[model samples]
Target: MVARSTCQPRRGFCFFMSAKRPQSGLLAGRAPTVSADAYHWRMRYQRIDLNLLVALDVLLAERNVTRAAERMHITQSAMSGVLARLRDHFGDQLLVPVGRTMQLTPRAESLVEPVRDIVLRVDSALGTQPDFDPATAQRHFVVIASDYVSRVMLAEVVRRVAAMAPGLTFDIRPTSEIMLGELEQGRADFLITPAHLTAADHPQEVLFDDTYKVLACLQHPDLAGGVTVEQYRSLGHVVYQNERGINPWFEQWYANQYGSTRRVEVITHSFTLIPRFIVGTRRITTIQTRLANQFAQSLAVQIFDPPMETPRLTEVLQWHRLRETDAAVQWVREQIVAGSHAMPPI
Candidate 1:
């Protein structure tokens, strides 16, 4: 005789196990027992293919068969076949066409977060090393940071690490509103941004704090002596605006305090470009002191203390919660923090 039981370790997942009864002596008519480890391995290997989960993740993310194929490095037809299998297994049309675009079915939408979590956990478990040797480790890290932070902090961090770990590489991407999502999805290893912008779910540390400064052309007649509050507000301004038209931290503060009293002469998407627009013009811009000083050294711009008190800008370094124990990640984070400490006082 055989005894059968079902196990469910996670929601939406079920496993069945069968054990034969012992036939003799003291153990007769008793069912054999299966260890938890044995049950897990049997369910994983015999019932599911992890590769399919990976494919499903990619498919849901892309939502387009051709693009999913391109991302997975498989043929379009192959991706379609994988989709068919996933649909059969899940008993739902995971991706259905809505006009020309594809949309996730309700079931597929429900699986996105859990599936990503499982994939990241598995990757972390398999990729963790007992120890890390920076000198010989071949590793690549992806960082998301604003251009201002990149220039003032991350540039120095990379330079220092290059000398210590020649085999390590970095891919730095610009900071965006979706940066936290990138970190959660394992697409970014580090995020350097203002403290307020960081996600509460992650672990973060204060990299540095900087004050705001008013920047104007060196030859601007009104600001030659010094800028007064009236002059600061009356002057045309060059400001930073992201692609999504969201204002920077200082801009938001300015709006609340002064409310459109200052005229914006120019709006740019780049933080570093703010000085370029200010130079050779009467326009003025408020920027972080660290970046403003760097620009003042080479450009014909004069830095002044803001006429009105502004909030301090605190830049922070954040990483995924799951990577807290990852040795390589911790090593790189230490290097970055050390670099921040070594920077000249603003």
Candidate 2:
């Protein structure tokens, strides 16, 4: 029927009414729902019935209400009601029981692939995708190293960062704990250390290689230029130890080379205090070159060439496999390499 213009301001606006009389429309004897206004008002608020898809999918897969409900973690009665709704919606007996078990009809079988495709499409469109940006990243990085290496290059690292990337920062922690798990589990970003860790521990990079040197008090006439294998053996010695004794190989090599044990008169695990011991006395000390240069400016100890040859020490840069791909970490490695090249020989 034509709508009467209720007294609204718009001239063309008028509500429309369903022309169908009772007993002939979609709801049989119910009142009509018509016009864009009435249709939208009803359509916008209608609750979707998701049970149709659930029951249809389960029925096609299981072909039995009780089994489908068990698969869905619901009771059989609930599934029975769902199956009844599905049958009514499709206007077909989708599943038929024969003898002992149920089977899907042709119509139900045809719906399987299409239903699965629709569910997959919906999932793909709704799933989240993650992105990582370096400039705005506020991530904590932990590096493990000995106090020896830390003292040598850490200041340069910090200063270099301020000039290059003011936004990035790092923390270097020293510990002798087994670190493979720490790196594997994302606890530490990298490690620069002297000890030879096993292969299972972490990925690694060779930072720089170094050899031994003798730093003796310049006042000692015996060590004016360099100490002999004989003089080095006779002179009082200072050894840096990680725990109890210095590396057994270093000790063995010292003995094997000079046919006498090193005169390790004083032993301290702390390298920081070694300079004070060598500076005031006529004693001689053997140490790594980086420590020698660091002490050169402050102490009267003169760094001289070693009288005997020894194996070079490999100072490695190590990290958890996870940090290997990270840009900030890569930059840190590059800076370390650059700064290490400038370090004096041992």
Residue-level error in angstroms, candidate 1, position 197: 1.6
lDDT of 2 by residue, 1-346 (tens): 1122222211001111112211100000112224354345235423425335634555676677887666454568777877777788677888888889987788778666554333222222222113334445433457777677777876677677667656555677664555554443334567676546534545676777766778887676776656787887788988766674534335556667665566778777776788788877877777777778888878787888887787667777776443344455566677777877776554
Score every model by TM-score. 0.84, 0.55
Off by over 4 Å in 1: 1-46
Going through the candidates in the order shown, the clash numbers are 0, 1
Distance from true location, Cα of 174 in model 2, Å: 2.2
Positional deviation of 279 in candidate 2, in angstroms? 1.1
Clashing pairs in 2: 289-346
- Scored by lDDT, model 1 comes in at 0.76
- Candidate 1 TM-score, true structure as reference: 0.84
What lDDT does each candidate get? 0.76, 0.58
lDDT of 1 by residue, 1-346 (tens): 0112232111111111113211110100112244454445435534556667767778888899998766555578877988988898788999999999999999898778767665565555444554778888766688899899999989989998999988778889988889999887877888998898998988899999999999989999887778898998789999998889999899999999889899888999999888878877889999999999999899999899988899999999998776777777888999999988988997
